[model samples]
Target chain A: MASRSMWRSLHYSAKRRVVSPAQYRCFSCSLRAQDQGKTDSEKMTHFGFTNVPESQKESLVGAVFSSVASSYDTMNDLMSLGIHRLWKDHFVRTLNPGSPLARRHNETEGQGWNILDIAGGTGDVAFRMLDHATNVNHDRQTRVTIADINPDMLAEGKKRSIATPYYNTGRLSFMEANAQTMPSIPDNSVDLYTVVFGIRNFTDKQAALNEAFRVLKPGGVFACMEFSKVNNDLFNAVYKRWSFSAIPLIGQVVAGDRDSYQYLVESIEKFPSQEEFRAMIHKAGFMIPGRGYEDLTGGIAAIHKGVKPLA
Target chain B: MGAVILARPGRSGVLSSLQKAATASSRTQCRQNHFHPPVQYRKQELPFRAAPTRSCRLYHSQFHPRAPTHEYTNSQTTILSAALEHIPSHGFTLEALTLGARDAGFLDVSVQLLPRGEFDLILFWLASRRGLLRAKVEENQFESLRSVSSVEAKTKLLILERLKMNQDIAHKWQDALALMSLPSNIPLSLSELHALSSDILTLAGDSAVDTAWYTNRLGVAAVYASAELVMTSQKPHADFAAIEAFVQRRFEDRTALAEKITGFKQYLGFVGSTAIGLGRSWGLKI
Candidate 1:
């Protein structure tokens, strides 16, 4: 209402022949642009604080991940001050991929869980789950399929996996796949679906969630660990100052890429609060456990879990 | 303010926020009627808002499509209830909680769900027993208690029945008592105690909604707490005979105290009226 009247006054003033800077942002221009938009039907989405065409966001995000692929581990350590490791560790342990109870079932005669780690480009979470399953459960039959949209990230992940005992173990595999649609991965196939710090980057979050629900077995779990809205005012202000100022500078100095880290920082702010995302999961037809999401480090990050309801 | 700061993902423009904040007086009106600009100006003016996600009351409600309003999850309840079976061997310790989680087919670390660690386990037992006590009273509220004459006698039966419910776990009750007395744990412990006493009052059909209602509940709480203390202290066995006699004597003393208070109130009322009558006769404004 306020903007409309302001525009009306600006219009009357322009009609009086007093050319103003407001004329450049005149509502008539926007109306003309809206008229043109009806012909093209271009959708827009947030790329970092800027609005870009929806179709272009994927490539823009891909470029950032490809650039940060090699130093992703180091950058994660630097950005969260190595707390991301603990968050990821807790995320995996919460699911407890290969526990003794599951091993005792022997339904498939020692055939293990079909874990799908989405946007698991650098294999940070995938490697941890495999390590946990091997060391804790001692059942080597469990397999993990790491799916990523970026080839550069997958290459970096492969290089890292060579350093661990899981290299070429046949228990680990990598595939190129978008989270929104994966024809290669069939329905009711996955036992555990994990996306850590990755769901926020998707162009269509609900579509991705629907795909997760489609791929999960009746009782499979969908777990996501992401940088969420910080709950504390003082902490959030300090974090914003650190992220908006310090992180880009660190990225510029160490990685020589301020833009990617800046995108990373803005993306965290763009992600939903812990509660909203939990509702999205619930809306996608998964049963929420407890309050649906667990806050970590004063809610700077949260773990959201949902189980596919069995009919 | 948190909601304001989180609005409009494309709020990277300089002039737009200033314009909105300066011109917009009421935020609730502004949020409901957002003025979206064209695609080109959206980045420079109003950000393209996503379809508003459904806002839910941040509390658990039956109609709300959220998790159930249970203090503990099904798995947690299973683990805790199973943990009760191991109380005789392991007491109210973490070992018992862990053993219970394992027996419930959960991972050893499943005990982490009980965030307060062992204290939550203790709270679970206390709350569940209170639930059991309610069931017991409701079951025999009329059937067995019709023979017991007065409300006092019926209330006595209820309190003694509650005390006897603790007999199976009497040996382990000492540790539960110690945990409940902790400063941090006292609030929950006291609330449980408050619930039990009130349950006894309502079950005995004491509908006194005046000051005596409070006194009655408090009286029951005192008698039960003291009697439970005595039961836990007795070695080799819980002497129900002595506990029953103790409850009987405590009720008798409570009745005497009530009579004294009532008599005092009546005497005070009589004296005040008499003084007022003398003032009226002396022509003062009584």
Candidate 2:
């Protein structure tokens, strides 16, 4: 009931037409708004819609993932109307592991593809990539490492992988590592680094991009598929209304968890638009090809690609 | 103004409409950042309403749109420019781009850097030639253009100057035209064409922010395209005189049509004012 009341107020606050200022600025809302100057370099970052200390965001996000880890895929299907499946499938196909596209210059020619799937905990993308490399390309040397910040999510992935042929084949690996800091991953070791529906959750998206740049070899590709700002204003309005109202309600009725789902919606809202994110990628020293992105489903989601410059 | 602002070599940060929308998006992001959103875009900030966006938008240069083909990297500049010399012999093919890669001291596989392949070579040729034409006009290097005073005649001079650039590679351009017309490449190709027309207009001092602006650019683009088509159909060096005559006639036709439209508009204005005066005489407030 408290979640329902919060949703009602948040919806009103987003509109700011029906709800009065006093009604919308609940105790925590005002605190977050005017509390900017206390931290140096403004360590305050968004946790869902409200601003929170950057130090606490990791744990807050971890809690959200942990609560929803088992039902993560199910929720994704429900929220995106199962369009995420098609997006992920298309993403892997675009990457097209084991193809000559994976080879950098000439060195990694015969060793097959070395791919790092960042924030890909569920093995959804990793499995598909391995399958494509195996069944489609007829190349058995391709390998995928799934990295995620949430252990619960990784565990869910590991559990799901038990039935697949890649379990004992040494083609799959999982790492519980944050996207912003993957210290265990050596520099320039990967040919293709992919982050699907991720990179937005990080407290500092630029840091994650820098990490991605650091890990990829020269001539290596970086691909990302994430929810992006809709190109059409009318479509964006409908998307916003649907996400804001239907998603949290669905979360509450199904998983009995509202805050996690609300956080998901607000984070998408807070994430940088496609153009802004492309600029960030450029600042991180990645060379992107034409427009840097391809809008899917009319920019409801976009796939951004960049290549590390071969100096 | 949507005019050409000359960029030094390897600094092709042209003002694309995408970048303009990016600036607008940053303002939207700024508004969305706060609970009580602050107003942006003060009317006073726009010093030159005639030029809706130019020097003013650079205040937020941090929000680079980073769109492709706008800002070529040093290596892309090197390879693409080197690739241009190979085009007359290689006819905008991958072989020329590969030879260019070798000439630029990069590996043969480095041609992969230009992912669009042969089409990228043609774009580099178009963009570099446009830049050259702008430089020629900017430095007042065109002796023919110095004789012209009005924007229309100067525009014709500039069009001929631009078309004359194809003398060396005019034979190879049919393939480039085919590549530019490909379904996938059409948007970028059309944009390059639009940029060329816009540059020619700006250089000719056509800053009328009205229907004339659109008509003038469209007229210039039409004349240039038809003239180039006529050039490609004939022998290169020998047919330039014919191409120039064709351009001159097209420009004359366009100017005549524009004059007719202006005369018609004036006639309509007279009728409109007469009706308004009649309404006033009938004691009706307009």
* TM-score of each model, paired residue for residue: 0.63, 0.55
lDDT of each residue in B1-286, candidate 2, tens digit only: 2322232223334445445554455555544322332123232332112111122222123123211223455566787899888888888987687667657765443554565778878878888898888887778788888888998788888888899898888888899999989999888787788778987887787755445667777778888888887777887567577887888788778768878988999999999999999999999989
Per residue, candidate 1 scores C-alpha lDDT tens digits across A9-122 of 212222223324333222333333344434256787787676666776776666455433343445456666877677778877767666444433433443677889988867
Model 1: residues >4 Å from true position, as ranges? Answer: A1-39, A72-74, A102-114, A130-143, A168-171, B1-132, B139-142, B149-153, B159-190, B207-286
Q: What TM value does chain A in model 1 reach?
A: 0.85
Residue-by-residue lDDT tens digits, candidate 2, A72-176: 455556667777778777777756566433334644443666889887776788889999989887768889999988776677679879988999667899999
How good is the docking of model 1, by CAPRI class?
Answer: incorrect
* TM-score of candidate 1 versus the correct structure, residues matched by position: 0.63
Where's the lowest-lDDT run of ten residues in candidate 2 chain A? A1-10
Q: Give the number of the best model, judged by lDDT.
A: 2
Cα error of candidate 1 at position B122, Å: 6.6
lDDT of each: 0.68, 0.70
Compared to the true structure, candidate 2 yields what TM-score?
A: 0.55
